[model samples]
Target: MTSYAFTFPGQGSQAVGMGKDLAAAYPEARAVFQEVDEALGQRLSAIMFEGPEDILRLTENAQPALMAVSLAIVRVLEARGLRVSGHAAYVAGHSLGEYSALAAAGAFTIADTARLLKTRGQAMQKAVPVGHGAMAALLGLDLAVASEVADAASQGEVCAVANDNAPGQVVVSGTVAAVERAVELAKAKGAKRALLLPVSAPFHCALMQPAADAMAQALAEIEMRAPLLPLVANVLAAPVSDPAEIRRLLVEQVTGVVRWTESVRWLTGPGGVTNLAELGTGKVLTGLAKRIDPQAIATAVSTPADIDAFVAQLGL
Candidate 1:
């Protein structure tokens, strides 16, 4: 029996025509898009299937749109008689993807998750002014070095580590000037690349505290049940099942570091997770899984063909 985990992707993984094929091939996927569209009071699926690029990439739209696709895949899987609780030992996701994981695990309904993510995206975007904040990726630098780079660059302006993505990949977020300074410092520190990201706001840093507060309020209004399976929370890099704690962590995740590298290590090491299924639009998490632990089998379940293959691999 193989121990399996299902992972979902976050922002930046959204594309122009995501989930079009699935919507065409599976009614489950179509209904998911419809449900999200109704929940958000917008036809986001059209934007997802035929995007104007900028509109679909808007944080509010992207967050829920991505979740819809992930949930669609989850529903399709369940329709195939392979449910997350039955097969997955745990569920994890990156940033906005965390809501998707919880939704899959039955902590929240699909419609509730969509509305929550929409609120989250709107709150996060509103937390910082457009030109005041930024995020940057510091490549070829480990977490310690990246932290140093962030610290040295912060001239008292809030530059801080955001995502510890992998062994040599870390993201820093803060004031634009501080992030720019961190890039230069990273270059000086021999980072292969230190480039500013095109994100709308600086996320996972103190600047996002306002957004965290907003999420705390929004999350309190929803009924959070314990997930069907535990979630490897982004902020803690550990599995957490308590609904109260999960709500708190979701709030903290707004302004806390995403311990992605450590989370993956914990899954492969102590959790003994051998298979990672990235069920979403892109191969982003699949790539991360391979980079983090090549020994584990990582599969991207996007297409109908992929769905069949994954089912076959599971001996269904």
Candidate 2:
């Protein structure tokens, strides 16, 4: 029997008007947005539906907002009798999407995940001052070469690999000068392209130590159960079942590189996962998964139409 993997997207996939169709069509889906809004004590759903673009793009808003949309889609799928627990062998998310995976796996309630992401977003946004840090994507460089470039560029400043997105795509983050130097070094080292990213904060680097510390404290107070399914953690790229281990990794992920390439390899190779279902707002993870493993069947579910197609395919 072929097994399934459920992958969730993180920050950048968020866009205005996400989940509105499901919310309108399914009462179960609409209830998810309502719960998140009440949990946050604000009209976050309104902002996601009718974003001023800037407000939704803010780190603080984007994290929880994306999670809410992802969960809403999950609810609609469940209401149609497609249970994630029965379908998925493993669940994983890119960066903050990990929280969404945990919620989907029943490790934490949607309410708790929303609250945690809100605090995490605010803490990460405040970690480094606005203009002090930066991130850059070094395209056409493998993880090893990208690491070398970041290390060479760091002059006692915090340049480090942030995201190992694919075979030839890696993102480095650190102090503005260090990141700038890394870009130049990558370009000089025969990288096909090295460009500065438009991200507001330098994420998944040593510069986020303060944010990591803050998350350590926040996660301590929350109750985390072992996920019903194993979660392939972002930092380690391995399936972890212990709740304590999950909490520790969540904190470490703040200042650690997202080993996405290694993660996908583990899932498709050793973990024996196939048929990846991207149960979130965007096709970003599906596209990346296909790039990582051309033979893998990756699906993206965002709206009512997507849900209908998926259920029909499964003969559910």
lDDT of 2 by residue, 1-316 (tens): 6888889999899899987787889898889999999999989999989988899999989999989988888888888887887888899999999999999999999999999999999999999999999999999998899999999999999899999988899999999999999999999999999999988899999889999999999999999999989999999999998999999999999999899888988999998987888988989989889889988888999878888998897778
Q: Give per-residue CA lDDT, model 1, range 86-123, as digits (tens).
A: 99999999999999999999999999999999999999
Point out where model 1 deviates above 4 Å.
none
TM-score of each: 0.99, 0.98
Where does candidate 2 stray beyond 4 Å? none
Q: Which prediction has the highest TM-score against the true structure?
A: 1
Q: What is the lDDT of residue 215 in candidate 1?
A: 97
Local distance difference test values of all predictions, in order = 0.94, 0.92
RMSD for each of the candidates: 0.7, 0.9
lDDT of 2 at 20: 79
TM value for model 1: 0.99
